[model samples]
Target: MSTQVPPIHSTAAAPMLELRGVHTHIGAYHILHGVDLTVPRGQLTMLLGRNGAGKTTTLRTIMGLWQASQGRVLLGGEDITRLPTPAIARQSVAYVPENMGIFADLSVKENLLLAARQARHAGQMDEERLQWIFGLFPAVQKFWNHPAGKLSGGQKQMVAVARAIVEPRDLLIIDEPSKGLAPAIIHKMIAAFEQLKAAGVTILLVEQNLAFAKRLGDSVAVMDNGRVVHAGRMADLAADTDLQQSLLGLAL
Candidate 1:
């Protein structure tokens, strides 16, 4: 059985996700300053920035982990700015945090099981989707019964991502999927993401890996001082070295 996701044309549809003039305050600190971003339907949007530039904060605000002090978050044109985290998640959005949130003590299968809300047990889980995920990350299957804590960093990261896709998701927001990964593992990660893109998942990624970003990103947004300073096609950004230097202080 084919598990291919139906493609949504990137140019013709409204954005899968949008943030307008978003502001977030983490305790006494104001982290985000009116971030405006658009994740086009069925395309991967890379969020690039220097450290502490509020990339992660913007993602968190969209996921409702951090409430926006101002502005709005919209998913499929529905206002979700003030929705609780669970409510937002129920709207078919999946978030993989920078920390790669997973239960260390739980088996890899158990970790994935928790993400399949409609499935109360492994038998009830979607076999086709599980097989599809295994094709993307074999480590998840190889370590199915092993404690997630026992897996290496790359494997754990794989499990984190695999968990997010256990069920079909309309939008996937991942923070640094390539961070702290070995080159070989990063290559596999890139391939998996490419397949995800081909399958028409609308993804927003906060990535410091410019090479990885260039390969998988369809659209690019560069953040600095808590605001997006540049937004355009990934190819345009990749082809312009001076623009890369100005926005990111480095070439792709």
Candidate 2:
């Protein structure tokens, strides 16, 4: 019932993360079917798919939240398929789920403080880095003392990303950062991600917004029926309207 995806060539000399023939099962339902993906180092890779297409499942599997039933997940040339979630995170990888994952009961500052392993208190967190993050997402500074739950959706999203980057990370994986956000907030998010990429962070994003993907992604992989149906440069996919509609069921 599924159409086949032609092989996608590697655009980067070396990939920062790769999923090779991965399979994931949820209860009796098989989610990912031999998914192959590559995220190049220091680049923004977009994972796009229709609903029920297993984009989030793929991200979760990479994060070790859901164990892969088969295959390998490589990070920086190391096999991390079986590592625990914390261990994976400690490997300089950060994952932000769709829920924004901030502690609603904690203040924005507290939430960020908790994310930094070296910092016990706000004073202990890297001052220069914190300032840089604040500059990228000013909402974080504006709502510093407010409970994360009290902030608006967009501000909370900022806190979530700020927490992920509270410390330097090699890879950052986020799920649908633009979901339910206003156009203006989404634009700001786009800018923040651009800055993060500039700071040498390799990012893997599971997004449904075509405009967001086109704006920020250097590489793209499209999933359907749990397999990557397309992989190539973002510009290649963006420029081909017919191919976009075929893979994603919509024009770019």
Q: How would you encode candidate 1's per-residue C-alpha lDDT over 94-158 as one tens digit per residue?
A: 99999999899999999999999999999999999999899889999999999999999999999
TM-scores across all candidates?
0.94, 0.94
After TM-score superposition, the amount by which residue 249's alpha carbon in candidate 1 deviates from its true location, in angstroms, is 0.9
Note the Cα lDDT for every prediction shown.
Answer: 0.92, 0.93
Q: Candidate 2: give the clashing pairs.
A: none
Error of 1 at 245 (Å): 0.8
lDDT of 1: 0.92
TM-score of 2: 0.94
- What's the CA error at residue 207 for candidate 2, in Å? 0.9
